[model samples]
Target: MADLELLDKSIRRVPDFPKPGILFYDITSVFVNPEAFKYCIDKMVEIYKDSEIEAIAGVDSRGFLFAAPLAEKLGIPMVLIRKKGKLPGDTYSCKYALEYGTAEVEVHKADVEKGKKYLVVDDLIATGGTLVAARNLIEQGGGKVTDFFGVIGLPELNYEKVLAPSKITTLINYSGK
Candidate 1:
């Protein structure tokens, strides 16, 4: 198979998922492929290795899955941006509108350090609302977001609207129907 075809085959796509028109691109298939999963992380590391990121902040839920291994490999701390009230101690939060409604994400105040560079990780980027909220919280805590990385991206969603002043990296990009 061609390289692109091979890579796409390993990702499972669920149609009309989470809503009537959403197509969820799932990466569980990659978890079963050691080489593919390793390639995924290696690519991310290569891109951000020289970015001098002191911390990797992962958005709640799926973001944790990617940040854990990446942080271990890079030997940096990993902070969780969780759902409101999920974090212990002093926290900062940002609320945004989701596809259906509104939601809030939080991060501990102590997890971020002044003048430190950070990378935000999430499963995918649709409209970029969630990641933007996470980035705002990081910057509010004195951390700078060097880049936003994800496994998949919905190019049609116009991430630039939310990430206007920043850029993002993704292993795969899709313009779903």
Candidate 2:
């Protein structure tokens, strides 16, 4: 079994980050701690190791860190789900709401294969807007998102309801104040 207790303890919480009245759950600390990082990958690998995941779709920047190693371990290709304009050539893009504004994400047009199953990975799942947009972008390119995995989740943000019907997994969790 995964030692979620340790994972929880390893996480660093900072108050009033990016703006006041916001508590940021930083995953960078996990990257710094060898055991914490290993546990995250090990748990993720254990969860999807037996599945038919054609490719792993990592949701920009941080997601790439976890997805790359897991995809390699699972012997599957990893696809970049990047910010709009970050990827060149033809691409699939979608906009999603943020706490303060809106942001866009995209994937290379040729990366997604029709009817292929994919797993989306990210560092955190807060309001689920970003992941929802990522899923829509994948579907637009004819790829199906079988599941979504994140290192931390805040269900207080109603992420489950927002990402309904799709399997959502998180290694650590936090409740809102």
Candidate 3:
């Protein structure tokens, strides 16, 4: 078992965020702590380092932070997954439901080479909507998503129903209890 004592300690929980009856796991604290940040990136790198990953694909917003450092450490290029219409020039998009409303995300069609292996990174996995959308964009661009990595995961959400069956590795887990 991967204990997340330090990882949990570094995370700050915000209740009823963006909607009622929801508690969001805020990662700014972990982002600020040098040891914690390095631990997270290092752990992720350790697991996927031998996965023959050619690119580090990060989900929009918070995912960009970890993806950048992970890419640098792994000596690979990083692809940024963004909200719909955020990317310019021949992009791929996927729309999905949010806690309150519908939203869409996009990626540059040329970001990844065909048949390249990629690891998708994100800050959290609540409903797995964002990760799945990102994976869709990557596949649409012809890259194979070998794994989905996150800093936190909520087991209460239907992860299996959303994301394609793939190796999911996380540094911390808060089951939405």
Best by TM-score: 2
For all predicted structures, in order, the TM-scores are 0.92, 0.95, 0.92
Residue 74 of model 3, lDDT score: 82
Off by over 4 Å in 3: 1-3
Q: Considering every candidate listed, which one attains the maximal lDDT?
A: 2
RMSD to native, candidate 3: 2.1
Q: What C-alpha lDDT values do all the predictions have?
A: 0.85, 0.90, 0.84
Which 10 residues in a row give candidate 3 its minimum summed lDDT?
1-10
Residue pairs clashing in model 3 are: none
Q: Where does candidate 1 clash, by residue pair?
A: none
Provide backbone clash counts, one per model.
0, 0, 0
Q: Which parts of model 2 have CA positions greater than 4 angstroms off?
A: none
lDDT per residue (tens digit) for residues 62-158 in model 2: 9999999999999998899898889877998899889899999999989988898999999999999999999998899898998999999998888
Residue-level error in angstroms, candidate 1, position 61: 1.4
Q: How well does candidate 1 score on lDDT at residue 39?
A: 72
Candidate 3, residue 22: lDDT: 73
Q: Supply candidate 2's per-residue lDDT for 8.
A: 80
